[model samples]
Target chain A: MTTTSARAAAADVVIRTAGLIKDYRSARRGRTTGHVRALDGLDLEVRRGEVFGFLGPNGAGKSTTIRILLDQLRPTAGYAEVLGATPAAGGPAVRARIGYLPGELAMQGRETAGDLLEHLVRLRGGRGSGRIGPLAERFGLDLTKPIRSLSKGNKQKVGVIQAFLHAPELLILDEPTSGLDPLLQQEFLAMVREATADGATVFMSSHVLSEVEIIAERVAIVREGRIVDLDDVATLRHHAGQQVALRFADPIRADEFAEIPGVEDVEVTDHTVRCLLRGEPDALLKAAAAHHVVRWVAEDRELEDLFLDFYRVPAGELHAEAEEVVVHGR
Target chain B: MAVDTAARTPTPAPADRNGARADGTRLPVARWVLREQRRSLTLWAISLAAITAMYLAFYPSMATDEMEAVMAGLPEALMSGMGWDRIATGSGYLESTIYGLLAPALLLVFGIAAGARLLAGHEEDGSLELEGTAPVSRRQLLLERFAALTFGLFVLCAALGVATLVLAPALGMEVTSGNILAATLGLWLFVLAMATVSFAVGAATGRRALALGVGAGLAVFAYMADTIGEMMAGGDWLSTISPFGWYLGGDPLTQGVDGAGYALLAGLVVVALLAGLLRFERRDLGV
Candidate 1:
């Protein structure tokens, strides 16, 4: 199964991992050492020219995966390749073509944003300053202010600008919109779209479901260091469906709505009925219309709730849902 | 967006865009590291120069025969341990008082602090993640940071040497330019060896406390061994293994340069630096 998907995405596989595993050990005096498995047989693939979202909660090894891709950390077992080259073999050459923003952005020294950016450009072998002016303007960042003096949002802007200033072939951003205002977050999303439009690939990791839904075409949901669900945004939205709640003028029988298609977890209490509605809602709507409707409310199920559901269900059950989507979408 | 406009602008060719060179060499990471340490380097140089100037200025008043007689009456063991046995001669006084004990001690503090900041401090603050993600390899980053440390130490020693040279004539001291240069060179090498040890340990462990503890503990032990070893029976050989002994063992000021001692110091530096680079390359960063 892995080989089949690998062949399908062979032409444009920007990032690939095979049975990747990372383990951390802690040793204390007079006690046996303890070990934690950060990543366990994780296999993932990211394609070029696409904005791929890596979604996971804290301690899900999201940062560990990013560090491995950048060659900052070596995996305990298995392999990872970026841009068709293993990170260890082609380390500097591969990193040169990629821009990365860490989950927590911290700048050292007393250098101003301009000084640090210029220095980073030189480290990449670019002459003078490479296109920082326009980026700073877009992010509304002041170039002359010292990085330590900048607020969290402004520091994030510096991180974002540095990653984009070099115009590399790929951008790997971890929690890119963190510490930014709502308006700035929107601007950041626009910048990501602009980068993708210019034929660059973006691999972003975040726990924010709405942000990923806004920008990513596809997402890989990781749990306990392994990717459990990989699907298109539209398909996940279709499977998640909408939550429907209705209060009728007359008391309705609980079995009256039992025959409605695409409804689950139905609960009928006195004059109120609440349930999850998937697929077409026409049948549920028609059932609700049989009696005079005093108040009707149907809200789209949040992607965050769907993500929690993915976490609650067993991997085999989620795989079954994904398989159904793949069969139907094909 | 501005990115669109900048993209549309006629930029250089793809080769230039990637910032690769025909010689396959990119920009040196050392330059960036050096730039970051500029302010601290200046402060260290100035502080070292001030200390040297103060000692040189008081040489004239302390060069009297009465002072020499008083120093001579002191206990032989105590004077030898303090390195004040030769407190009358110009070169001997400078070597025993400053270069032998005080200068290296102060410079070790400087070196250890700088080394800790280079690796462990950055790691603690989470800035290493951003720096490590660049085009530079781990070996390149470690080497460049070590280069910055070496450069800063050189500047501090150079400042001290020039200040001593300028003050010698005014204070009626008969110190040769060669002696001053030799002493400064020995002090620089000693401090550099200590700093390299700190850097290597820090890079390997990625913890500031361990680096400071190990580096400082070694320095303190070496100093104690050199000072108190002379009084202990059969402890004369203790100084042989100490870095302080390797540095001041040759009496660099009066005897000119100790080629073999300098060679040993350089060798220690290389071995430690290689160990650091290897450990850094193999381990995880910002852990």
Candidate 2:
């Protein structure tokens, strides 16, 4: 069920789905059974120009949602709208204005990257040939090789180029950074940001929390075909704190370390120790100074912690415990 | 990193409609089908050319004196295997030879090509998934593919027709332009029927080897059944079920043109085509 509040009304949304569901009937057993409920009453809305990160673990509805938006898969029930028109009615024009990188991109083996790009461009009603070179150059892709000869990562690069070649208004990428190295990942995020700046909206799905945390303006985390959390990353991070590590020059006894206010749990191995701390780090640092402060590292809990938290894995069961610490702002 | 200082840039060129025809001219589904078949098309064309040449090379002796030997002395086992015994010499020896050999070869090639296109080729390369996402509907995809298969059969038939026209004079065989054309068309219909069967098999199994194997097996079975039924029953009634039976009954060598038989073959082709299309449309891709 979708709750249309005042903020959603003001955003001029480009894509929205209400109570979306998809069921797959298995063919093998001759008996009509084992329906995979890939998507279940998913309620999602993406506003214009915002880079919405759709995060979920494997078997969640991330790819399913993107497929529904592209009109590749029919929903068992519920309604989906893209750019103000129903996905069913959107047809080629809707496809023309949207760039999509499918979760699995296995292209025809015989065609060269240039030929494939040319064909896709023509399908999008563009001057297909010349754009292939420019797109390949921008993505650092080689267009001369046959599709079969290229590795999976290179093939993904070709898919990326073809998707971006048409310069569609909305880019829906599923696990876009999987094949990219760290440098390329940064470049790709830059490209996405540039596209967003030009009024194009990017709705990306990924399981990588760190990558999502880097550029996502708002994120929706899906678990078991349901949206578990949807909010700004900074806000989620503030509520979920950072992970901290500290090392003392002298060996600190376990009982002595446990007595500190903010140090929730402490593990001592010989002269080194690790602690999970909540709130500010100044108080913990002061406590550690009584022994000998050799090296100190204090950082907030990562997005993974917040993601795991939403799964209802109790705080006691979590390996790390949270503690409150007092820090004075200089 | 700071936001792009360029503030705003003009919307990138409005999405290109790549290469889909403008104003929706809708090229006959044949073009798209051929586009998918691009890899193996040249090799298929070359093989068809070679088969036509071979058929032409042996037409002389096979049509005349040797024809009498084939009728009187050929082993029953070989005769049954080749579907040769059922063709009466009264229908003319040349028709018997052409009907016995060329018809089966055409049907086999058609089935093989259909199997490759519908099953192994698409599944192996993953274009099957890509096609599932394309704007083209499932029925449209099948129709276009069938159209290409029909066109390929036409080219093969034309090659055989040209070969027959050239071989008739050297062999002193009676071969009218009308008879050769009618027989070629009849042969094409037989191949089309087989292709349609393969199309259905491919859709049902979604496996290349299974579709090709089952289609070829079905054609051979239909031929053998018709031939055996004819030898024992001594009537054309039972042969009506087999495409091979229809083509032979058309008598491309002697009758010049069996319009009624050819018409029946065309009817069967249409029926098979409709059945295949319906099955394909209903079945899911990438299954």
Candidate 3:
């Protein structure tokens, strides 16, 4: 079922991008002033029936990639294919099979949630109009109440439901759980599960790693508009490697633990043996037992640290980094 | 599975009735766009009707012998500049005041202001994304919004026309009903041409303020050129180029319909719309 196509495994690849580049040109009075490379030679491939988490900090070009995928923004260079077709050429036919939740939802309409949902459903060819009631009920959304009157959480609920209403083949959610309460976040995960169970491919972007870490089987970590790492969620966590520090009762020779398998950077400073350990630490633990270790502190390497290492903004340039995002004009 | 079954809220009122009706039309966005503005459109129509009625009711008192003598004493150039040159006759009085200045001004306001907001307003507030990403193509979406804007203009124009035709005779104003129809049609075409331009600008830029500025800006420039063009070196040329000149210069009230002028206005609408869509298709939205 998966034959490798010219560029990708076309049969199984739900979303694919190759060297996609987007440059934001800041202009004044129709003259280009400067440019920021929002997406720098980004390549991505999302397979069918998988929740692919796009992990990156702010200004890592997460939203830019989502917009390009949705056809809201065009790439300055390269190509993107969603649901077996290039979005630009396919247009509505391609869009019809996809549902997207924008990171920024406009909650300025005067119509009630019910009215807005009904109106949009009709525009989407009225396919999923019947599900609106059940979805609203599940979310505790007062459908009759006007959208402007709703609280932030409730407004986000409206947005969440709308994205799932059509039940398309692919769902691209940008910061889907940003405004939800913990309870609602669970319900949202359930929704994602339901969508996936129905054979939908999910591509969700999040700066917060834990939320995505729970559901995303695989993830791509981006930094400065380029992917620094891409791997299975469990594999990435394993690759992070543990940080271990053992304080011993007796003076210890650093050479004793140096020969232990799966341990490196062994250091002995005043009977405190500290080192970076990978895989099972059983061998190192056995070696440390010989030194009459008084205090053993071994911390499993948190993927959060690794995520931050890959995505953290270099300090002293926060102002400029933020400005690039602002000047990027979304 | 965090499906909180115990907290099941009441389901939304069946399928939305308005939605059902909208789907039947096969032009849901267009129908929905018009339906959502029903209250505002009604208010605009009522206000237009009331204004026309109020203006027409004053014609009898304004056409007395003393008023004619006063009009005669006024300088001809001054009277012409004020759009009140033919104020003595029944048709002339309507032409100079009601047909010439008042109705056209109100229509332009309704057309340009409403037109500019038709697309850009939705776009600026961010709701345009709902339609923009729906199953419909961008081209279909633009055409639907444009159609709704055009139809809304008709409602406003009809309100003014109905008021004039029904109330003019009751007030002893000897205005020809046929000429009234011609003038109303002429006014619709003129205002529509301008509104379409405003619409096209908004569609292309997705900036309501800029779109509105261009719309209002064009109206001001056209009105000035039309109002003062007669005294300028090449006056006849202004009458041909300016929309206001096509509208008030030909004086639809006394002269009846100008077929060529109406055609030009219609043609301008098509041209402006196509130009706007070209940019709309290429540019990024809500930038």
Best-fitting candidate, measured by DockQ?
Answer: 1
TM-score of chain B of each: 0.91, 0.74, 0.88
Clash counts per candidate, in order, are 0, 22, 0
User: Which pairs clash in model 1?
Assistant: none
* lDDT tens readout by residue for model 3, B94-150: 766666777778878878877788788888888787678777877888888889888
Give the whole-model CA lDDT for all candidates, comma-separated: 0.82, 0.67, 0.80
**What's the lDDT for residue A328 in model 2?**
15
Stretches of candidate 2 off by over 4 Å are A1-11, A27-33, A127-129, A245-297, A305-330, B1-39, B63-70, B73-99, B110-116, B119-125, B200-214, B234-237, B256-284
Restricting to chain A, the TM-score for each candidate equals: 0.88, 0.79, 0.84
Compose the digit string of candidate 2's lDDT tens values, residues A1-330.
236754774468888988988887865656776788877788888888889999988878888788778766668889889888876687656766777887777776566777666556544444334456755675678888777888878888877766665556788898998888787688688778777877899999999889988988888888667666666777667656655666777666877678776566588876777877755667777777778767767678788876776566542333232221111111
Runs in model 1 deviating more than 4 A are A1-8, A29-32, A247-249, A253-262, A280-297, A313-330, B1-10, B13-28
User: Model 2: C-alpha RMSD to truth?
Assistant: 5.8
Query: DockQ, per-model, please?
Result: 0.52, 0.23, 0.40
Worst 10 residues of 3 chain B by lDDT: B4-13
Clashes of 3: 0
